[model samples]
Target: MLGRRHLLGTTAGAIATTSLLDRTRAWAQQQPFQPEPGATLRFLRWSRFLEAEDRATTENIRAFSEATGVPVRIDSVWQDDVLPQLSVAAGIGNGPDLAWTLHSTPHLFADKVLDLTDVADYIGGKYGGWYPLIEQYGKRDGRWIGISNLVIGVLPVYRVSAAREAGFDSFPTDSDGFLRLCAGLKRIGKPAGFAFGRAPSDGNSFCHWLLWSQGGRLVDENNAVALNSPETLRAVEYARELASHFIPGTIAWNDASNNSAFLAGQVSLTNNAVSIYGKARADGMAMADDIAYANWPVGPVGVPTELHLVYPFIGFRYSRYPNATKALLTFMLEGPQYERVLQSSAGYVSQALHAYDDSPVWRSDPHITVFRDVAARGRPLSYAGALGTQAATAFSEGIVADMFAEAIGGQVSPREAVARAERRALRIYRS
Candidate 1:
């Protein structure tokens, strides 16, 4: 029952005889670690991930199933639900072999996830090396707790036509210019929304950008409570100013809100994944032509800083088939499967591995090419600090996002918001 499933597959004879599967299997065998193909792989994926951009991964799942004779069940839930379900599974010590987890999960649940150091090292060595943020998200302490597959490379999705309308022929590349850009957009009734509220995809990712770009950090080198610095106060004040210019209801937006705002012609700019573009292209929406992307404005600190949306693949410690799980992940990351997935997602998914950096998908579109550098330029929320239980807890509770919301909502001063956030950060760090 262990390793016999592939051989006992109903279509084993036919699938086994295919040249691609045969060669892939032989490649699997040559590896120092090979797991017996399991009967089934129960997977829980983020529902947001299954959108049109998810075609490559969705397709490869079928292909992997046929290639390995392993039946895979993929349960798609929203990004918010993924964490709760994963927490329950980890708590009860029983769940899918692999669950879609967020950036800090590998560190937060280090004890509950299967170690994939060997697999990570193998893949990293073969692929160009893993990027910095991948190391922070997937490797906790000294072990690799999960396999990071993609960075939801987020950047400003703006209306090129709107920029021109605002008297700018090109997107601004610095903070001062960005400030003016948003103000101009607001004057034109095309106020940009940055979701100072708790937008999982937009606000969550951008908060770190605002902070880091302004030379502020959640924690210092010692991973202590460092959220109340002067730079952070400036970031909060900047957020407040930006909020005044954002479309109304930004404080309450979720991941989908900004996408809706942009598609509806309500926003001039906002940070997001490529899903908006993918959906527009799919429907041949007229707004698609006006849409364009730009990297973040350089902050006082230096390089293009951002909080990359990192989604990881976690194998539960309760799994009966880690080897099979490893095989599936490895196969998925391999050139043939991964490239298809990236293409299917329409550049919404950027690989953590540098090896795939040359993907042609980036070149296919004039607007999307900026994303090729987004992943490389981004970092996790706990920038300059380790991603662990403390930071994960803080981020999950939306402490940072709420701080901006409160300040922007005019419910609290920027200083007051930073102070409140500081206290919360201390508790989480010391927890």
Candidate 2:
């Protein structure tokens, strides 16, 4: 049963009222291979992740069925709107046999999930490679609960030709220079100089790096909240300043929104996932002469900029077929399935070790090379402590979004927003 609070908070409440199990059971039983004569394998994943166009994730599953002679079942669920409901389902032991989610999710389902350390070890030793970034995030208290097959990061993408025309030799080297560059572009009438997206998550993600760049810590080793520090305020102020030059429709932008603006030549430069590069190329957005990539700019901390990555979190509590679950994950990591997922989608990079070698995915593409370079120096946001997801959600949906709004709205001073956010953040930490 969905809690009243859960009902009031999200659309998941509505899904809870529907009958999900009967449909799932029937679906699972209908698949080609039954690992056990009486058992079936069901996969709960983001529908968008296994899109009709994203043939790799699907094909890999199909190949798994063929190779292992075990039938695979898929249940596509949207990550953002439906994951909470799925979490509820998992807690009650009704979740899918295999799950796909962010690195932070397994903690929420920790007890209900299998510790994948042994499985990861078994697979990595026998199968061959694993994504370095995914492998790192899969650990909790030094145990692996999931294996992320996809390791994706964001980079600052720019138009070298347009940047040069704006009287810049290259993209600015630091956050201040980047701000000045935006201001310069506005002075010359580019209208949109920078893109810090307005979605709750995007706002939070961009600010994390911004704060880090300015030497701001959201939390310290003592597990105390640190958003109120002066350095963090300055970082907020800088983002506020840059927000002023965003494309007219930026506030309405979600993750994919900026990509369209960039492809249409409405913005000069912005940070984005490498996958967008594939979209631009597909749309014929002028490759040879227009696009380029760079490390997202450094800030006051002189820190290397990094984009937040989402890793796959698999659990065991809901899986009736543990051996099959292990088998599927093993297949994802060490087999041809890994390479297939990389090439299955445009700009989808694999997380497998040394997978980039001799692969047309990287070798033939110059734009991708830029991202590969950035990944080498990237850092995960400080995982303050115990409640990684809650802390992350608060920072993103609350502090960052609120400060960014105040900055863009020009209502409260950025400093005021920062101070207010600090107080609120402290509450989150203390709670």
Candidate 3:
């Protein structure tokens, strides 16, 4: 795996030599792919939260079509609905030729996706290399089944004034301090909140952080079910306590609920991508200046255990225009096209490639810089175990999120919640 140090330490001479060799190999092997005649493509992606991002994507598609003569039709759905749509497509073998979907989608549909190793190789060689964590989502058994596209940094978004009113001069860096801050915010009548429902991104992001930050794992390094442990119980118990300081009805919150609540001044704190802050500033809300960002508090694990939203572009094996799809993806990842999307995202979406780390958009604002290292520091959805069908199944089924929700909602004790989750996870991993 390529760590941050290795990525940063790569010398300019090495990159130039590697790029030359890659170009030579492509020429010798007649690679870089060519679109078949009369080929057209269809692409599906999650709906964009930022207008700039949406416009940039449309512009890129138009540019690709103009350059390659391969007309592309793009469609979008809500983030939570993307996986189900892709599943249906895979089952019927007649959906979009390519999709940009979130974590575990590639693993869940590994057998149905086309191999893109050549595409990945060319892109990574030309633009430094992919981040270490990105490989976990894009590759299956050393075969490239997907291209890791975007890393949505999921961190703490809070009101600066409200935090000061709650007696915090700065955001907390540890779980204990975080709990105190939450309690203080509650006392001031501006409580913190996090999604507990079946929100595909926000719910899983925070709950997984809660579990893993406490040194808990759903599976061991050997992939055995390991959810029933003191660490898990502690995490669940902490979640319960944290929930007491939350706004009412967070249990039913979807992916967009917290953003709505925060902007409406109903919640002082929440965990989300930078979209909340972006929206606030875009619409000129009064609270825009009061908004600030912070990384997740470190728990007993003594490190960052964040699980950001990762979007990977997967191509279905059933597509007749496989070559066109590959070529289009390659076009999108090139420096000019990729930088357009990155600058437009305003740090809402981070790049998975190491070369883009020097993008000026990251430093465009002080609050945005906190998200720059997310792709390097964040963990994959499947932590402490290999990512596969079992891990994907367990996460999509909301096993960990449900465990926290049940305990927080008073339906079960923390220990019982842990036990129930263990049974469900065991059933998945054992199969």
Candidate 4:
């Protein structure tokens, strides 16, 4: 916990005493990285859900620019658009010099991205260290291709009154109770909904949880296709039942659809990030007081099998100002700058580094506290298999999500859907 006091406390007529500040200063003195003359940096990131977060990031970029005397151009796009744009940039060896990419994206373009091991090592040593699961997302072949930064926690957000009406004293902790709750809600006319379409974060988060919670996986640890199995059939069957209780048009829902439906009171429950709650409170919506969050229900696996969105700061190897890019990345993760962004996010984004666990933001509100352990409790996108090009390809193509959607939409039987998903996984894994 890098508290605000530690970050702001200054020695008599001297610099701040923060360990990150002191260590970074020491490292700079020992091996100063000189930026190329006339270097400018371009950074692309997903547009923020919280306005304060965006403002804080802009401030950090401004401070970095002022300190380094290097002007930086920052661009933001919709969350789903980032990977496709980054893929194009990687393929053509041109575009933004750096980007904050989502899950397993760095793995997909590992060869096109700069090796960030040195940058990762510096930050990890100065801070507590990266969370355990971060290595799975940021590293490949023992080389760090990106700096795992923040995790967007996807959890169950529901209206408290609705849950009470559903006859549950609290949110369910297991799969069977969860289904009953949903069924109860639907009978009462406030059904729960989860994105089943091509939502980059929400769709993958919910669909992957459905599969993993039931002990189904796209691949085995050996990276063999494993989607066509009894476990997968069970998951699809469960999805079919679950989708029947969902609001209509969920099969076409994108990342923003559930957010819209939830906020508009069209759905009483949905799996989403804390941004929905943040938006409710920020806009003074009446439902803000009715909103509460809960951890995803445990399934037959008997452990937490949730997936979350991870943002990694990756620099392109083709960047003209590699040193400057590295410098900017290091600057952002420094305690003061990073802490401000986290604080402003209000727990919508969990820290990727373990040291920030005690940050005041997580404790600021009880409703948001459920997000604090996301990085610790959640699995990587490539769970039960290696995180690499193959896994990235399968995830990006949404094979698992599509399988659930296809089955729920009655385009195929559950078994057929599982077989189709397995066939798709085989194509990618065997390629």
Candidate 5:
């Protein structure tokens, strides 16, 4: 299995072979061309959501088989399982024809991944409504290395009922109201007013979004470490205060624990990604109905709520059947099949605005609306050659979880943590 860190490199040779075939076809264009048959396509997908015997993934695979009359096989695995599988693929050439994983982590696969710039031009030329931020997120060194058919946004997941019970009729649209909402939740015996997990990745998501909303930049347009600024410190201080109201257990919580606590109804508010809604529905948890989402609240600076995003897709880099791959990707993007996947998987929202036009998930779900709005305004996660990965690691490891544990757990001040994060990040950048 390939680790997420190196999954992209897993099928490098195969991509080369596929690119060779594409070039061969290009050279043969002057001759009368006949469609080739018996070309099998394989895909590595997030198996849990769509691969179960009767699930959306399974059905989508079936539909792909029918739509193209080409046999499509998928090696399904859990999202977390992909890294380990890719680790194996890196050693043994047994991975699928295409992989669907996080766009941020695709750098791990950059060497082996196909540059989809031409494919993106094709998709955009035809669809003309793909997520702009996602297109940017999928690129590395000015070439499209991945495609994000789905978009995820970070936001505040709140207990609407709890807020109303606490005498707030509407969700807060700004930062002060958010703090006040937390305070009010505390007054009503929700000891844990809001909670976010202590994973460096989770922290990176929160920190970047906070900075973006406050008119702060992790790196300027020029790409330098900007984590030590007064603006950033203010964001950290505000986060520290919010951490103070987190459930006592968050000190030890990683990604799962925080979501578990939120799921268990121990917390009233959580600033998290939109993926939670799907998880909530899958579990059929009682709190699911009570859960509603809001834009990452505006800061004092009047920046709207921001979200750290994840973009995902299946690319044609290793496809023996480009037409088939294009057909499948296009089908998933253009119709109800795509919506079914998004709704059932509780995955990220589609990057397409028209996707919202016909979606019950967009129209009927409160959380979905906030997520959609954030998508409309948000930028992709910041990346600068190696800086994005390094910063993500630093923020995830040094600042997010560990620092919160130290500061809110009575070991240090938030200021100290931010300074430490800056020093550590600078070292990583310099190194």
Candidate 6:
């Protein structure tokens, strides 16, 4: 479609761009960061992100290293690897300067983290203000012990074509409708999926939203155990019925299984991060256009309740490079560098800063536009309550996921499952 001269010019332009990027990386890597007499910044981050975004992060970190003379070392680990690594590090009071993890790891180790109130306050004052949920996720008592980094949009990804065949022309808008739809889906080979195992993130997130949307909560705003209640009873009963339509082996599924299930067309519906949909589009997979994302179905409460697994970076109290660590986080979260991270992620990563909610990534794709406002909506793990030692302990213990799993397993009655969960919660709270 191009003339020889035009093709040559385009090739030259790409070559020049590559050359410039290579030079930039070389310069950044060469320049040593030594902000002060004794300064070093080490980051432990999840290796998984949009590939280009991870590259951008590495480059940005190198630039930070160059600018501050603080040799920044980024140790990338899998999401699953992060928490255990952080736990051991916190237990010993020694680890990477910035411990990156999801859920309530920060709150679980708040006592071992350096107070970052200044970091939080400065960012809040400069960028309008911190989101209400970000404060709860990052703060300990009254001090900010962690830097809430970003959110990955978690919502329902379903096959529209399959839904149509299942005798539904539109997505379910509420829990009861959702139940009937799943039942219909089961009539066909395709089944709705919300992981039923102790499989952590996806399972817990969906079950919690299921409970919360039904006017149930693990704890109230007052930090009281709200797991055992009439609302929870109804939720569990609803969940038990819904689980009947789940795909086989959902009970043993880890996070990746759902993605595969959705892609393989074995599932008509599933709760997943944008990653699932993003991957389909990126890879030009067969099922790409057939997929659509939707909000969590509403419930009797008439409010949309959703849970997102948030990865917040916390500076350990034992870090000798606390100041540098704080600066690194602040740098990543602000200005052009932050925007670059968001842009390169291609709608996969959402920001805590409300101003950044207008990120163009979601707008890039029509189907994914649902994720644009998700950052402002989804609640953290400790939602409907506080992120504290008790709540963190319960989440880390996987008791909540177990509760829902128990209800669906039908080995125990829904009431018994909640009672068991309540007993665990009371023990956690009392401890």
Model 3 residue runs over 4 Å out of place are 1-31
Per-residue error for 63 in candidate 3, Å, reads: 1.5
Task: Report the poorest 10 consecutive residues by lDDT, candidate 6.
Answer: 27-36
RMSD (CA, angstroms), candidate 1: 6.0
lDDT tens string, model 4, 354-396?
8899999988999999899998889988889998889888988
Question: How well is each residue in 252-342 modelled by candidate 6, as lDDT tens digits?
Answer: 7888889888888778799887788778887999888888888888899997787776778788889887777777777777656677777
- Across 349-393, the per-residue lDDT of candidate 3 in tens digits comes to 898898999899987998899998899878988888988889888
Q: Which is better, 2 or 6, measured by TM-score?
A: 6
Output the better candidate (3/5) by lDDT: 3
- Give RMSD to native, each candidate: 6.0, 10.7, 8.7, 5.4, 9.7, 4.2
The residue-by-residue lDDT of candidate 1 on 243-262, one tens digit each, is 77778998888888888888
Evaluate all candidate structures by whole-model CA lDDT and list the values in order: 0.80, 0.63, 0.87, 0.87, 0.60, 0.79
Mind sharing the TM-score for model 6? 0.89
Please state the error at residue 142 of candidate 4 in Å: 0.9
Q: Model 6 shows how many backbone clashes?
A: 4
* lDDT comparison, 2 vs 5, better candidate: 2
Residue 41, candidate 6: alpha-carbon lDDT: 68
Find the 10 residues in a row with the least total lDDT in model 4: 12-21
* lDDT of prediction 2: 0.63
